[model samples]
Target: MTYKQEQLSEEKVFKDPVHRYVHVRDRVIWDLIATPEFQRLRRIKQLGTTNLTFHGAEHSRFNHSLGVYEIVRRIISVFEDRPHWNKEERLLCLCAALLHDLGHGPFSHSFEKVFKLDHEIFTQKIITGDTEINRVLEKVEKGFSQKVADVIAKTYQDKLVVSLISSQIDADRMDYLIRDAYFTGVSYGHFDMERIMRVMRPMEDQVVIKSTGMHAVEDYIMSRYQMYWQVYFHPVTRSAEVILSKILHRAKDLFEADDFTFKLEPTHFLSFFRGDVRLEEYLKLDESIVYYYFQAWQDEDDVILKDLCERFMNRRLFKYVEFNPNLQMKDWMELYTLFQQADINPEYYLVVDSSSDLPYDFYRPGEEEERLPIHLLMPDRSLKELSRHSDIVEAISGKKRTDHKLYFPKDRIEALTDQSLKKKIITILYGQGEVEDVR
Candidate 1:
């Protein structure tokens, strides 16, 4: 069968918690799902390290990837019956959705920051490089793999198809928001996805929601905002992330130290420590392998590395206090000095984590990260910007909100021999004991 006509004898169905059932009809998609690269997602958590805070967040990328593919499949099926929709791009959209997140490494946020790596770069490589995924794409047709990668990169010529996969409101975000909420057991992520999809129309270069479905769309945006602060940006989740990033930084530094002997060879991290990780080497690294190294490092001679690993493994995350690092530069330095005197190593202990987002935005000229403003297709056959119509989104549109927190291991500081230092630190963290502890 030709790529356009390829199909499984019987459609394959995977019962999903978020999308009900993910049905796969194309042979290429079926084969791609069985590849080693795609299967690797099973070992990587969807929300890395969030499991330490919300224990139910143990879902893997594999689950979310499949959900994305199913969403795109359903969208394509609907688009097929509408005007301006092309049937030729059917398989292309599905494959792109399925493999978009294929190259994410273990604890990607920390690993990417420490190693200066980009999972998107590796994603394109896996699709275009010499891998099982590439081999399967080549079977469908030569050059099919690059087209899929370009869709994920948002550089593809078919803007409608690209928007369906990666635009501001696309299959990827829609799937994760719902899927993550389901696993995290949070109520903020609930929205009318079915109604939103019904109103989603394929425009010349983007997807626009019908005015009749404005409330559903509004709910989706609010859900995204709620999910961001309530679940994705939870302080406890950030606490685990703080320890994770420190562990990676400490390990990289220790690797550079003279005659550093690792009880367990960091076979997966050698190239990363040297700042040159090849695609093949990167594909070998996963959550399991990373955790194994952390377990081994707990027995290492480096106290920081050992302690950080213990903190991560034992769920002993750092406590955080709200602080504007820019305005409190002097306060930050004082804490740094205190940490050093207490032998806590401020470099790893005193961490400032920032989470920022513009709840909504209109297309602005010459901006770095420009998001296409949400457009509502009015009954008069004219388009209106979302913020102009919705007061809720307007109040927050183009207004960037940022939250800063100073993270430190309270237990370590409290263990200091000097009672005065502990009292000062407590005062700095919470003046007059505002709360018993930082959750």
Candidate 2:
């Protein structure tokens, strides 16, 4: 048999907390997993700074990736005998599922935001670039690496294949929801994943759920909604993220400043700071490497960089208050000026973070980021959008909810010797004797 057709003599199983057991029988998958690029995921935290808030959320992308592969494995098993399900695409789907998150850097989203990088673009690069992952994929077949890259890029010719990985209710989402919930020790991310998988039907261009499984799909949607608010977007987690982003910003600014010299060279981040990160440099960075820099930078000459690093390393996170940009613009401006006058750098210390989510949405073409609506297969084999059939989904569908928080160093403000300035900032943040403990 060709390498592409090779199977393991005995299936390799990973005992997983979320999926019970992740079974791997394909030799190609085994080889891919052994690749250094894939193994690097072991060091990258799945939830970034969320560990600060939910102490148990220390799982790695490696765990989540395997769960996704297992979920897709079970899903393809059901599709094996179904119409419109291409057997040739089975390995492709599995490979994509396993390697979908390959390019996530340390503290994934924060790094992306500060560096102007997209993990998806890096994912395609890793699959197609000069790398062991590409070599493994190339061994599958000529041009197979590009096929995997295309699947991940959502540009593959087979829309059905793309949907299996990138659609509204794909294996990636299913795994992360439950897997994140399991690690975070939260009840919000649980749902009948087995039921959803069993009811999943392959179609010409996408996967659909049977009418009988509408409730299961609804549960899944609501679980995602709750997970976002209860755990994923927890205020404490956001606070850590804010500090992390500020650290990156400070380091980058210092790098660009001619007078600033680091106590220790930020070797791993130089490429990111310079905006010319190559694949090898990108892969070499993990949470440990980042933490090492954050620790070392605590002793740096740059006070802002040193302070931010210390705060991140020691969990001296900034406190946040509900902020409305529109109604409180004048107040925000006044606070920004007061922070500067009080010897605090407003650029690094005062930040407004906004998080928004649409739990569910029907298709609306021509929108900036169009979400392909979930569809339920009717008893008569016709298709209906999810919200159309489920009232629970309809009520929340198409409704976008946004939250805005103004984050500042409460400790620093409280420490100020200038009594009048401190009182003004406090009054603005907490109206009239409402200065309760934020933590």
Candidate 3:
């Protein structure tokens, strides 16, 4: 029998913390899940360095990936009964959802930022290249893997299928919001996901929510906004990411230097440092391997690499104060020189991190990340765009909110022998009399 025609004799169910039961009936999905490539996700954290802040956010990408698959499965099951839905695209949606984050490497954001790589590109490679995922997809049908990859790449002909995985309010966002909130033990991501699923309707080109489900959709948007600020963009997590990026940058600089000695060589990172990372070399890295290197770098000859590694692994993270480069350029420059005068490499020790979010947006005619706006199917059979009708969603729609923070090691300044310099730094950070240590 063709792999596409295969099914388990009995459905396999995974007990998930968020979705409860991730039911798998397709033999292809079961086989794909057990493959080494997919299983590697077990070692990658869903929220890298978030565990340091929320102690409970120790969940792996494998956990969130399965939850995404389950959400797609449930959504597709309902879509199967709809008139406009193409039942042939069912498995493809499931595969795309399950593997959308397949190529996320260890500490994804920082690693990608350093390496100048996109996880989406790697995801396409994993699905369409000479790998286990590709082989399983091939057995299903000729070029089946390409179809799945196209869905993830948002280049498929069937816009409805593409919407299932990549649209404004699709399975990927739905699952991650709830899953991250669950792991991080925060209540911000809770929206009526089940009700939203019930209200979803397949359209000629995309999925739309029932007008009656406006409140639920509003809640989902709000949840996303809240989670972005309170959880995903948490200052502490960004501080850790800053250190991680600096460590990679420091290691690469030392590797390129004329006379640099190292106690522990970064075997997996050499290809990356050379700007020629192969897929095999990339796959070999996970958080565990990263931690191993951090432990070794602590004893390295380069003090900067050793310090950044120790800060990342030992929870001695840099602290931050709010700063806007637009209005506080002088403050930043002052702090920059003060840190240098204190014998700290301001480049590694001082960082300005910015995060922005647009809660919901209508489709722009020609924008870069051109997101298709969410449509609500009216009871009278008319279609209306979301923000136009929902006050809560409209208030934040197309309004890009940005946050900026300046990260530095306050501990070093506090420990300075020159109390006057320390006081100057503190005064510059806060105000004349405002001085309190932030860890």
The global C-alpha lDDT for each of the candidates, from Candidate 1 onward, is: 0.87, 0.92, 0.89
- Which ten contiguous residues of candidate 2 have the minimum total lDDT? 430-439
Q: 1 or 2: which has the higher lDDT?
A: 2
Task: Note each model's CA RMSD in angstroms.
Answer: 1.4, 1.2, 1.4
What are the per-residue Cα lDDT tens digits for candidate 1 across 4-73? 5778889899998888899988888899999999999999899998888788999999999999999888
**Any idea what lDDT model 1 has?**
0.87
- The stretch of ten residues in a row with the least summed lDDT in candidate 1 is 430-439
User: How well is each residue in 138-199 modelled by candidate 3, as lDDT tens digits?
Assistant: 98899999998898899999999899888889988998899899988999999999999988
| lDDT agreement of model 2 with the native | 0.92
Scored by TM-score, the top model is 2
* Candidate 1 stretches greater than 4 Å from native: 432-439
Off by over 4 Å in 3: 432-439
Tell me how many clashing residue pairs each candidate has.
Answer: 0, 0, 0
